[model samples]
Target: MSKNKIITVQNVTVTISSEELDDYICITDIAGVKSDQSRSADIIRNWLRNRSTLEYLSVWEQLYNPKFKVFESEHFKKQAGLLTFTPSVSEWIEQTGAVGLYVKRGRFGGTYAHKDIAFEFASAISPTFKLYLIKEFQRLKEEENSKERLEWTAKRFLSKNNYLIQTDAVKNYLIPKSNYKDNLEWLAYAKEADILNVALFGFTAKAWRDANPEMAGKSNVRDFATVNELTVLSNLETHNAQMIREGRDKKERFTILKDIAEYQLDILNEAEKIKIEEKEETEETV
Candidate 1:
């Protein structure tokens, strides 16, 4: 058998009863073992002979099974409560368009029907058992949802943390050495900062200006960036300046930039948990 994707709703052991029929069958989790080795034919035959059960089954078939033969169902209904009524799942399905009826043969066999049909069949087992199946299924879903939320939260927080680290690095290095002779020297410093801006935002100050000619005078990128990205930018500015003073090789600078990018990616992933905790606290207060 292929690996079964077990679905637990309430507490039901949901599995494909038969892939050929595409049936979703639910059984009680507490049921010791499911076996059809016994003399089940007689028991099954007797169950099908019941008048009320026959009516219910036929009604269900008519509702869901478009191929059900009303003519055969009429014949079965007439003999349902009569003197002697013998019925088999195969016989019923063959005669009428019944979605379910247990069978003993065939490859994609051993009782199979659609999910809705299977849920209805579960009633034949026990009502409380069906409820348990649903409950367990719901619990599984909630757990999966929680896991996904946590992952997203962690990524955001990591991004925020790395941003702060980079910012602090900048404050230590670049901010202390501000001196200029003319507007051009100041422009050079501004241009250097724009390298960090380009790596992060894909735009330089001058490019932003040319694009938005009307709003050319103001700083556009600073306002739009997240707190974390800005922090990283500051750190980069300071580090780059320090490296320039030491006359570091181009290869060394490039290597540092690569490391910083990887570090930022790692922190973004880590930030998810922090984000989730904060959200939970806010929710509790609200």
Candidate 2:
């Protein structure tokens, strides 16, 4: 990856920008890896000069898309080796009704093609580079997974903190007293636990407990949450507690926690936005 970790593949950034796709394909680095280039334009031009390259692109388009235009393709065939050759990924795409090559510009711009076309483009660039890109891409995925796991774990820890709060309350107010044997102390302990539960889970553990009271003593709310949800709740509780200690207003804490939860959930839900964008790009170029 370059300092900016941005590569110009076929004159576009290695990353695909969502704004560019509309009746055109964008090419992306197959691996989301980036590199600096000394005259990337020259590298692209050389690929265009290779007749086999054109045929490969043509075949890719034909196999994946039925509406590809042969008329423009024929023109490229005639002009392939001439000194005046000026075909570009974009030009080829436009002329041949391609759905696979995207010519994009600006920040986060890239020639992001579908993975199929992107791999072909990468192979054309440098087989070794393509291999490196794939390796790096796999590494990126692993890193992402690791980050998500760590986040989830952190969330579970936060949830446990809530349980700890309830336990501490029990020790302080419910235990070591004659009331330990009284239903009143038990009710008070349950009430405070319910508050922490509602704060973290948007409902009381007792609500869950009441709904399935049979499972109450054996399991708690956090234990049942999907890792992603637990992580978000944990984050929320930690932040909310900080706000409380800091004397921040309750209104501000609620809003901020809501934003945090929603943002994380969005990332979880749309983890494949980049991949999906690339896939759509390939379809256009094809």
RMSD (CA, Å), each prediction: 22.0, 20.6
* CA lDDT of each prediction against the hidden true structure: 0.54, 0.57
lDDT of 1: 0.54
1-286 per-residue lDDT for model 2 (tens digits):
1122333433434552322111222334433333345445555666666788788778877765567897778788878888889676778777788866666667545555655556666776668766665565556557767997887777678665654556554424321223221222233344433434444445556556665555578876666554456656657666665665454544455456656776876675476567778899999999
Best by lDDT: 2
Candidate 1 per-residue lDDT over residues 1-286, each given as its tens digit: 3223466554334554433334344232222122232543454455567776677777776665566687888787788766577877678888785755544344423444445544544555556765665565456557766996686456557555644565655433322222221122323344455555544544456655665555456535454345566556666666766665445644455447546744774585469668979999999999
What ranges in model 2 sit over 4 Å off? Answer: 1-38, 142-286
In model 1, the worst 10-residue window by lDDT is: 174-183
Q: Give each model a TM-score.
A: 0.38, 0.40
Superposed Cα deviation of residue 128, candidate 1 (Å): 2.3
Error of 2 at 101 (Å): 0.9
